[model samples]
Target: MTDETQIMEINKPISKTVVAIKRIDYVDIAKGIGIVLVVMGHNDFALISPFAHKLIYSFHMPMFFFMSGMFFKPDLPFLMYARHRFNRVLKPFLFMILFIYFASISFSNVGIPQASRRLIKALYGNGHYLDWVQLWFLPHLFVVSLFAYFFFQAVYRRGLFPLRWVILSVLFIGGVLGITLFWPFEPDILGRGFTVFGLPFSLDLVFVSGFFSSWGMS
Candidate 1:
């Protein structure tokens, strides 16, 4: 190889590192702020005024989804990207939720039958059903990130990035409508009157969170 080509090769990795550092710098700051807000929001019931608590809760979670989108790349194939996400997001979610659930069974007064029922509900991945409610964000984020990948891939592959905002807006609106229309349909399982809400894995919130993620991408 030419000396010039060697020099280019040496600089490429350095340049990439610098670019990545620059890209995530502000994102890191925003994420730090959001983290503090999330903690405060969770514990602020009597520590802060009602309006202050409301303000903190308003955007903390959406901010995370938005930041997650900022890291999206539409270049990877579907399975590869999905596997990567499974390892990074879903795996951690499963590990932590299981850890908490088992800890409750081992130490707390939770009985085996009750624990079994809770485990079943936890499969739904909805916060309301989990022992640790705050963990609901992980599975929800995992789904949103995957949805964003497909949505962006479709747009990018079709050379429709120019119209991405319009497409995203339509999809987001449809998602909202679907959620609204289905809000009342709590289907009973086995005619036992047990109902599931928001769908498994929080799939229903995809478009809602997608809007924030799209903003991050833009």
Candidate 2:
């Protein structure tokens, strides 16, 4: 063998330390813009153009959902994972539900009727247990993340690396397209509305897109 071939073979087994430095200034800027849009949307400000509103709605919540998934590493034990998820997701969800209910009461005076309907649905186990308009995404995300966690665990146990990611991508994309195609084009039904298949113009599609995007980022 030549000298170069000898050297290459000798060095082939050593691991390389490759550090990746991310330039996330654009991400930060986008997040800032998203926060502004969210505030304006909530306050009924006319500053947001209709096109901007549509664009923001398309990706803002999805971006936030992907951000939420970024911190979830799978190295922890199952019990620890459960605890962490509960604290991070469930606790905040409960708090938001209560807070929004009160806010609706104070600001709109339609709280009692809305809350009553939500409570009835919760009791009957139909629709989401919580009915806060801006807060529905939280519960949806929590559930989706939990499902993803378990799915990751199962794939990890099987010693699949890149193949698992491929499977996840296919499922996520297929789900998004399927839901978007079949989604109902109507407003949610009172108290009984639930759409896991991207009803009301592909809401779950965006969330699933965010979930898949999170995995792609890592």
Candidate 3:
């Protein structure tokens, strides 16, 4: 190899870090329970007991979202988090979309024009069921985590957290009222409600799940 190649290799990022984390058994158990509930809710056998599925659906998302938020560090650098999200969420998202898209082209009547249009929409995340129903949650969770990181730093990092909780209690009531009245939109904060497959990074869910994310942060 040339000296230029050697220099480039030496400058490359090591791309690995070792950190010890204490595992909390109950948290894992709760997440596992939520996962089971999510599966059961989607299973066709669940049609036999709709109310049970409803109960599972009611709490499972919140439980899952809360668990996701619980480990967020308010102090982590944004670029670091972006890199993490790109690896964990965006990579999987792109891979799955490509896999599903190609599978469709192979098995279905998807012509070049149709497939290209589908690719555009899928990349933008502009559909309610973007290519597949299950994949939407990862991007939505990614978006909500972004909101939580900033919100936690702004509210909690400055010692305003205790008072903010009191204020948030009132706001939570208002949020519930608004949700009840206005079809799940939250007045388009920070101008991020732009549309894509369904909402870019699942923007609408950012507000709703943000509550859970912030709660977990606390």
Candidate 4:
């Protein structure tokens, strides 16, 4: 009959329901498998087989993105999300880039002319060959994460059903088909120009699709 006792009784059912819902196990399994595969794929060891590499490349990173989307509920304010994202992504990207630049210079015997030219090209806009091989995923993943976060926020705000799997599938299919249709039959200036769009189409499509799919949207 007391106020405190009444409050406790009223909250008990809700708390128990939440506790029951929190015990889902599939998410943890998916995350564990994805992380293990990612680490194995990245490691420079003989343990990796071609089939394993292909499987990891196909699903591991995408699964990570999807898992991220599942938990993309921005509880903190927008400013907090922005600050966290900058610290987690942009700062590290800059530091790694600078580190790679200096490391290349320190280790390589390439003459000053060639190294300087390559450094200048990388700093300006022309992509570096080293970057093409090693750190390419960082920038691409950062962009995809930022996009997914903002997209999830918008979806939450609009009160839309997060079942966007069909929409994502359409985008993915359309993008692939469009790229295939415009595939260059011959090497030409314009043919090369079309290749630039390929990254956005393929990367973003996969990233967002994985996100939605992990959320049971697919």
| Top candidate by lDDT | 1
Q: If the candidates were sorted by their TM-score against the true structure, best first, what order would they fall in?
A: 1, 3, 2, 4
Mark the 10 consecutive residues where model 4 has the least summed lDDT.
193-202
lDDT digits (tens) for residues 1-218 of candidate 4: 99999998988855344444574599988877877776788776326477767767777666766666666545777778767766776576567666766777789776667766765544322123335343554555555556666656666456664545554666566755554442322435955632332342235344445454335421
Model 1 ranges with Cα > 4 A deviation: 1-23, 45-47, 182-184, 188-193
Model 1 lDDT per residue over 1-218, tens place: 99999998888854344443445678779988998888788884636588888877778888888888888877888899888988988898889877877888899998888887888888788776777888788888878878888777688677998898898889888888888554435676777664455677777778888888877776
What candidate 4 gets wrong by more than 4 Å, as runs, is 1-32, 42-49, 76-79, 111-134, 178-218
Q: Could you give candidate 3's per-residue lDDT for residues 1-218 as a string of tens digits?
A: 99999999999999878887988999989988987887887788467898887888888998888887788866669988867867877788889888888888899988868877777777755336476767878777777777877777778878888786665566556655554343333445597673323356666456667777777877
Off by over 4 Å in 2: 1-31, 40-48, 99-114, 120-131, 180-210
Poorest lDDT segment (10 consecutive residues) of candidate 3: 179-188
- The TM-score obtained by model 1 is 0.81
Model 3 regions lying over 4 Å from their true place: 1-22, 126-129, 167-198
Model 4's alpha-carbon lDDT is 0.57
1-218, model 2: which lDDT tens digit per residue? 99999999998988799999876886678678778867766664446477666776776666666665665667788778777777876678667656666677788867688776764443221123435456555555555566557766766557875687677777777776676464433445875754432332124554365455456335
| RMSD (Cα, Å) of model 1 | 6.6
Q: Is candidate 1 or candidate 2 better by TM-score?
A: 1
